[model samples]
Target: MIKIRNPEQILSHGDAASRKLVLEIADLTLARLDSYRRIKSIGRMEGSLLHIGTRSWDLLKKRNVYLFGAGKACNHMAMAVDEILGDYLTEGLAIVKVAEETDAFRKTKVFVGGHPLPNEEGYRASKMMIDLVQKSGPEDLFIVVISGGSSALMSCPIEGISLQDEIDATDVLLKSGAGIYEINAVRRHISAMNGGMLAKRIQDVGAELIGFGISDAVGSPATGNIGTPYAAYKSTPIGPDPTTLDDARATIINRDLGERLPRSIVDYLMNAGPEGETPKSFPHNTYFLLNTLPDSCIYAKQICDEIGIPALIVSSFLEGESRDAGTFFASMAREIQTYGNPIKPPCVLLSSGEVTTLISDNSVIRGHGGPGQEMAASFAIAAAKAPGACLLSVDTEGTDGTTKVAGGITDSSSFQSASNKGISLFRALREHSCFEALDAIGDVVFTGNTGTNLCDLNIVYVPGIDG
Candidate 1:
């Protein structure tokens, strides 16, 4: 069960039952994505046959087995694999967002790094990962694990590309309100391990690679959540590809990354060669998806079942501006409460997908918030229009944007709460400072290290007599 750190303050701000239900769903979603739980149910070792997901590995036949990855959830995934392989586990490395320098991690080298942004720590970890891959033998069986934040956590600057350039480019892309796919397209080019380059390197060494992923984006293969170092989507239409000059030009123009992005990044993308992604053929490679947004929504609905309330899975593939999605959800909840046309009242509307928030402006040096909080704060203002409706949007990974809180929830009472604290919702929204605004009203959600990542999970709930 997920425990909200300030339950009293949280429950005091909104409908207690509604906030409780929201937390229940968040807990269920994380539980489903727990790396240990996932590995236990799907992986097993019997003699030489090691089963994970739908594939079986002939361990006795293989020479050496290696595990490596980068992500927020990589720690737990590494822990689970270590437990499963036991004495059979040859060696492993994982770069995670948080640190716990314990004996368990020593058994499988773990490095802590920055998230949402890459730093020197990430550079060190990524460099080490490159060294590990290069040193491995041809007959090695590489089990690559990937989850949200892997893009940054596994950063390795290509030649001529400084870490600062990559950081500036990433910062702009993130703040420019681009979707995961578009942001990935830009970042993959500068990265040494993304865009199938890692897979190509593993192939060059004659090592066989396999992947286990927990998607944190809208699409599967093309979405960049799948370890490009290990697997490729069989489907050509949405399969992986390197970021092209045309891609960069379009993204920059659309999201205005040029004005804010680093000059080095712009030059690299503009002059990038035609040699983008390598061939998609993977004779010795296989990949498996451990969890997805749609799968988690089913688990959330199960909780709704126990509560005897109608639950609707509105959109699992939601995307675009965080504020747009947030305010739109508020309006939708308002509609459900007032008209009850599409979905009857006394219900929970669930949607799972990542959203983006364009920084109000990078010119000023002030605190900004993540998409989840932007949506929730926007709802707090919009909630005044819909008295009975509330919205809770959170990143399932237990961090929203760069804030300490997981996310935020708001209802009709949110306006009063804000007024009581003398906080201006309009100003917060304009400044893109939902983290601070939500903090003022005691509505920020908390569940440290949710042990999973499948994008953002949103709940639009309206309480009625039935609920």
Candidate 2:
């Protein structure tokens, strides 16, 4: 009966309960991180490693192994693999956005690149990764480790597209309030290694290739779940013709491009080939593990229930626009408080999922913040609309985008403090500066790099006991 410390009190007393829930969520989030690390610890490579139930270990034994890992969690995942594989790792490479010098991979080469947007360094690193895999022979093994930010960290533009175009397009899709699937659809079309193109490249290569991924998407370990070449191909549809530049633009106005994907992307769908042509099946030996999201939600729910608060474990696959999702959750809080139908009073609604926000055009000059902060701000506005509800939204990874705070919390005092400071809550939301507003009122949650990412966790509590 592991319990979260006084969730009801945390909701009532802004100072104490706010801090407690923040720390509690951070602790639970770390548990998931530990689970991810444990997988690598137990799945270590000895002189030879065998698949779950295979007679042969030769596929992984005494081979020249090359590694390529990308994303915010990529560096950490790479570090774990390096520790487990050791001498068996003949050579390795990694690309990350925030550059941190580390001796984590003793024998592997490490490189830091930009994220959320690709830069020249990211391009160079991506090419190097492909070259490493290309060099592998039948006696070699290629291991690709991918995580959340890999799409940006491993960008290699398609022909006729410049890095700037890709960046601009990415900025548009992100700010367009599109979902992850839609955004990645456009990205797969423009990227060299995305949408299964990367897998196709090594399909005929003599060496065996295996992908180990950390899913930031709704489902776990599916094709394109981590932006691997296989996923890119499977998820996106290939159109009859490569969409011309003009055609792509026309589609934007005609369709809600944010909701619908581009024709070229659909055309290139790996599953779509010649008419009546059977698709090539993935290798029988390939393994895609389901290790994401669920553990964190279950643990968070346990803590809430133990604290004597009725807990509703909502969908682990929550997705879509950040602000809209915030509004929806805030509405749920209002219903629980006023109607007492969802779980009566004295209850916590817990949820985990990735939320996306559109980067504003003004970001060029004013710079917008991350999705977690936007969620916190939007939740506050919605909560303000309903007087007695308290809500907390945070990225489990501690750092939310470029900000140091994990996320923000909101209650009655949050609105009152805005009034006292002569600040308009609406203004803060418009500016995408929720962290600043929450900070002024002493409500921002900071956990300092919990060393893992499992999307976001949100908790809402309604006070008082209801019949």
> TM-score per candidate, in order?
0.90, 0.79
lDDT score of model 1? Answer: 0.73
lDDT of 1 by residue, 1-467 (tens): 54345567777756677777777766666676677677677788888788875567788877778788778778777887777777776888788887644426545877777788888887887677678779877778888777778878878778888988888888778877677767877777777876666777777788887777776656543232322233544311112444555666688778766768888777877777766433355556677666666666777887788878899988888887877887788788778877885788888898888887767466553566788888888777777777667777888877888886778888777877888889887788777777888888888888766667877888877765344
Cα lDDT for residue 404, model 2?
66
Backbone clash count for every predicted candidate, in the order shown: 0, 19
Q: Please identify model 2 stretches exceeding 4 Å from their true place.
A: 1-13, 47-60, 99-103, 219-281, 306-308, 358-367, 384-388, 401-404, 447-451, 465-467
Which predicted model would earn the best lDDT?
1
**Alpha carbon lDDT of each predicted model:** 0.73, 0.60
Number of clashing pairs, model 2? 19
The prediction achieving the highest TM-score against the true structure is 1
